[model samples]
Target: MSAFSDVELLHDFLTEAGDLLEDVDSKLVELEQSPEDAELLATVFRGFHTIKGGAGFLEATHLVELCHKTENLFDKLRSKKLLLDAEMMDSIMAATGEVHRMFGEMRNGHQPGAAPVELLDALDAAIEGRTVAAAAVVEQVAIQTASEQAHSPVVAEDDLDWAGLYEAVVGVAPRELEQAALSTGMATEAISRQAAAAVRPKAPASKAKAAGPATTTAKENSIRVDTVRFDQILNLSGEIGLTKNRLSCLFQSINAGVVNDDLIKSLDTVVGQLDMLVSDLQSAVMKARMQPVGRVFQKYSRLARDVSRQLGKDVELVIEGAETEVDKSILEELNDPLIHLVRNAVDHGIETIEDRIACGKNPKGIVNLSARQTGDHIVIEIQDDGRGMRPEIIREKAVEKGLISSEEAGQLSVQESLQLIFLPGFSTKDQISDISGRGVGMDVVKTNIQRLNGRIEIQSEPGHGSKITILLPLTLAILPVLMLKLEEQIYSLPLSSVREIIPIEEDRVQFVSGKPTMVVRGEVIPLLDLATLIGRESNPGPKVGVLAVSGDRACILAVDSLVGQDEVMIKPLEGIKPKGVAGATLSGEGLLVLVLELRELIEGKL
Candidate 1:
C-alpha cells in the first residue's frame, strides 16, 4: 500500500478520482440552485461512494474517512431524511475541497493526515439535521489563533520555533491553519516539516533516480484522446506507408537509367500525393491532441459561485461554446489566466446587489464566459453586466499610482485609459483584500496570455459592463509567420503580430524626434530596422515596412523585402538561446530561418 511501491496503481486511481471530484464539484454548485433535485443528490452520492471505494482499496485512510462522512450525508439527503440548506451546502463544499487537498497529498506520494475534527464534526451535525454556521466557526477559530500568537514568546533563529517553521514551510499561518482545521475537520496533530519528510515512501534506486518532482501531478502528463481520432491517425499512417512504397519503386526505376518525360511526370504526381498524405497525417495527430474547452470551463461555475458567496453578491456565471476544442497544452496553460479573469469579473466588474438595484439594473449580476474557434485561432471572452469602468477614474488611479503622469493620463483616449488597468501596481480599489485590490491579477493574466502567443483586449463602458477578449492560436506546434528577407538571410515573425506590409517610399517616411517614423492612418508609428534590432548589418535600400503590433505598441519593421507568409514547425536550438530568437525553422528550400520573438525585440524600443 506504500505510495512509492504502487506508483502505477496510484496513478490510475488519481486519474479516475480527479475527474470524478471535478464532476462532483460542478454538481454541488448546480444543487445549490436546485436544492431538491433528487437525481443530483443520487449522482453526487455515488461520486463520493466511488471515490471512497477507491481510497479504501489504496489504503488512503484519511481520504476514505473524509469521503465516508460526506457520502453518508448525501445518502441522507437523497433518502429525504434531511433537507438541503445553504449551510449544509457550504459544509459539503468544504468537505469536497478537503478531499481535493488530500488527493494532492497522495499525488505527492504522501498519505494525507487525518481530516480536521471541526469539519468532520460539522458534517456529523449536518447529518443529524443540525445547522453549522461556517462563518461563525471561521471567526471563532481566527480569534483563538490571534490569542495563541499574541501569548507566544518571540524566538531567535537558534530557538527552533516549530509552529512558525511549519507555517513558513507550508505557506499557512496560524490563522489560516485554524480556518483550514474548521473547514477540513482534520484531527489535531502537529505535522511538522521534518515529520512530512519522514513519511516519504522509500523507493527502489532506479525509481528514485527517475522520479520527477513530487509536485508533478499525473494529470499534467496525461491526455484523453477519442478512439475515433486515434483511428483517423492510424488510417493516415497506412496511407502514408503505401505512398512511401510507391515513391521507392519510382526511385528505383529512375536509378535503372529509365529517365523519361512520362517517368518524371509520374514522380511528380507521386510526390504531390505524398505531400497531401503527410499533411493529412499531421492534422490527424494534432486533432488527437485537441480537447474540448469544457474540460476547463466546467469548473468555473463552481468558482464563480464560491466568489459570489464570499462577497455577498448575487452573481451567476453563464457559459457558452464549451464544446469548442483547442490544443491540450493550451488548455492546461489557460486555466490560471481564465481563473483570474473570471474572479476579476465577479469581484471588480460585478456590483453589489444593493448597488445594482440602485442603478436600476438587475439585482443579480451576470458574467458570461464563452469560447469559439475563428479560422486557426480560438477566442475566449469574459463579459460581465455590472458597473462598467470609468476611463477618467482609471486614468486618475494610474496617475496616483505613478504608473503614468498626469499629462500622459490626460492625453489617453477612453480605450487607452481602460488599458491602464493591465499595468502592474495599478488598481482602482482603495483597500486590499484576499481578492482584487492588489492589482497583480490582471497583469499576470496579460503576461500569461502573451506567453501562449495570444493577445487580450479590454473594453468597458460607463454604466454598461466590461468585456475582455482573448485571441489565441489553435495550436503552438505550427506557427503562422510572415517571412521576410534581410539581404541573403531570411527571418519570420508571428503572423498574428503583423498587421500589414507597406512599401517604404522615401516621400512617405519622415523623421520624428530624430527617429524614422511614418503616419499610419492618424497614429504616428516608429520605424525600426529589423537588421539592426537583430544585431546584423542593415541591407541598403530596404523597401518593405512591416506594420506590426508587439504587445500594445505598434511599429514598422524595416526589412529588405517581403517573402510572403508561411506556417512553419518550430525547432528549438538546444544549448543555445539567442535573445529575440524564438526558435528555428526550415524554409521550403531547406534554408534555416530564425523565428523572431517580436515582443522581446521591441520591448523597450516603442
Candidate 2:
C-alpha cells in the first residue's frame, strides 16, 4: 500500500536482478559466438524468467514487461522454434540495456514505467522471425503499471457481471455482491475463488487437526554488512598495532632500568602474543575487503565483442586470472580504465581481417587480459596480438600538435617517443569518431591509474604486438613503504615505485645533456639528490640511491641512508597538502615519517 513498506522487497529484487542481468549479458555475448550452444540458450532463458518473476512481485512494471518479452524470445530460441540471428540478438541486448537503466531509476526512488512501444514491437516481431527495419528507439515513455500483489482478481471471460466485480475491487460492498462473481466461465477462476472465500462461513477445527506440523525450510544463516563497517574494523586493528608497538618499546626499556627479571619475561611474552594477534586481525580485515577482480573483468567480454564488431574487425578477447583478488574499491576504479584500454586495442591496435591476412597472420586478432599477484601488489596486463604502435608516427604527431619541436622529436628514443601518448591532446589519427582519435582517453587512463598509486608501462614492437602493464598496490588503506633516512628526518615512499637500489659514485656519474645521469643495465637513468629537490642544505656523500620508477622514467634519488622497510598504515591529510608529502605515518619511536608520492615529486623536480 505504501512505498515505505516495499523497501526490503525492492532491495531484494535489485540484488537478485543485478546478478541476473550480468549473467544474461555475458551469456548473450557467448551466444553470439556460438549460437548453437543449447546449454547457454537455456541458462539465459532461465535468467530472464527468474528476473521477470521478481520484477512482477515488486511491481517494476517496465522491468517485468521487458524481461517478459525477452524471456519469450529466448524460449523460442531454446526450443529451436526460432533461429538466433544478428538482428534478434541485437534486439535482446538492447532490451537488456533498458532493463539496466530502469533498475538505476528504481534505485534512486523513482518508479519506472514500461518499455518503449518500438522496442516491445521489435521483440514481438523477433519472436515470430520478423524484422523491424527502424532505427533503435532513443526515447522512453511510461505505461500504466499494476503490482501482481495488491491488485483486484481477474475474471477469465465475459461470463461474470463486470459492474459488480469492479465495485467489489474499488469499494466496500455487501457479501451478496461477491457471490455474483462465482458464476463465470473458466477464465474467471481468480474472481470466483475470491468470491467463494469472501462469502464462506468458518468452522472451528478439531484439536488433532490443529496440531499438524508446519512445513518450511529455515533460511540460510547470513547477513549483509556494509563495507564501511569493515573499514572501521581495519582502523581499529591499526590502532591496536600502534598500541603493540608502544608496548614493545616499553617492554624493552623497562628491562634495562628495573631489575625485575620475572616482570620483564611476562611483559615480553604478553607483548609477543599481542603482536601476533594484532597482525592476524589486521590481515583478516584486509581479506574482508578483498574481492575477486573477475567481477569487473566479466563486463569487458561483451565490450570487446561489441567494439570489435563495430570496427569491422575479427577480434577475440582471452581473459586469464579472473580469480585474482584485489581491494573492492580498486576494482570499482579499475572498470573504466580497463574499458578504455580494451577499446583502444580493438579500434587502434587490432587490424582488420584483410590487413591481418596480408600480414600472414590469422584473420582474427587476439586481445589478452591477464592478472597476477606479486608480493603486495596486483599486476594486470592488456595485450593485443595485432599491429603495434609506431614510435615514428607518435613522434611526428607530437611535433604536429606543438607538444615537441622537430629537434626535440628527433632526439627522442623509441621508448621515449611512445611516452608522448600520455600527453594531453596527442593523437595520430586524422579524423574523429565515437570511440577515440580526439586525443582524450589515453592521458586520462594514465592519470586514473596513477591516482590509485599504480604505474602503467607499454611495450610494443613495430609489427609484433603491444602490451600494457598496470601495477597497483594491494590496498589503499595501507601502504608498504621503503623508509629512507635523511639525517634526523625519515621519509617514506611506496615500495611499488622502487625498482632497485644502486650505489651512486661521483667518479662514475657524468653529465649527458645538462642533467646528471648514471648508467644502469645499459640504460641512462636520471640522478637527483634528495637535498637538492627539497631545498635542504646537506653535505653530499657516496650514499645509496633509490631508483624510483614512475610511468616510463627512472630517477635515482640520493639520500643520506637507507632505513629498513615496513608496512605503514597511512593517515590521510584533510586540507592544504604539503609540497612533497602524500601522507604521514607514525613510527614506533613516536617519529612522524612523511610518505612521498614518488610520481608527483619526480614530476615537480623535472
Which candidate tops lDDT?
A: 1
> In candidate 2, what are the lDDT values of residues 411-481, reduced to their tens digit?
99988888898898998788997667899878878977986898888999877889999999879877888
Q: Which regions of candidate 1 deviate over 4 angstroms? A: 1-4, 137-219, 503-509, 537-543, 572-579
- TM-scores for all candidates: the values are 0.83, 0.71
Would you list the C-alpha lDDT of every candidate in the order shown?
A: 0.78, 0.73
Off by over 4 Å in 2: 1-9, 134-260, 484-491, 498-547, 554-564, 573-581, 589-594
Give per-residue CA lDDT, model 1, range 404-517, as digits (tens): 999998899988888888898988889998666887867877877886799999888878999999999999888999999877566899998899988898898899879999
Candidate 1 has a TM-score of 0.83
Q: Candidate 2 — number of clashing residue pairs?
A: 2
Return the clash pairs for model 2, or none.
Answer: 156-187, 156-188
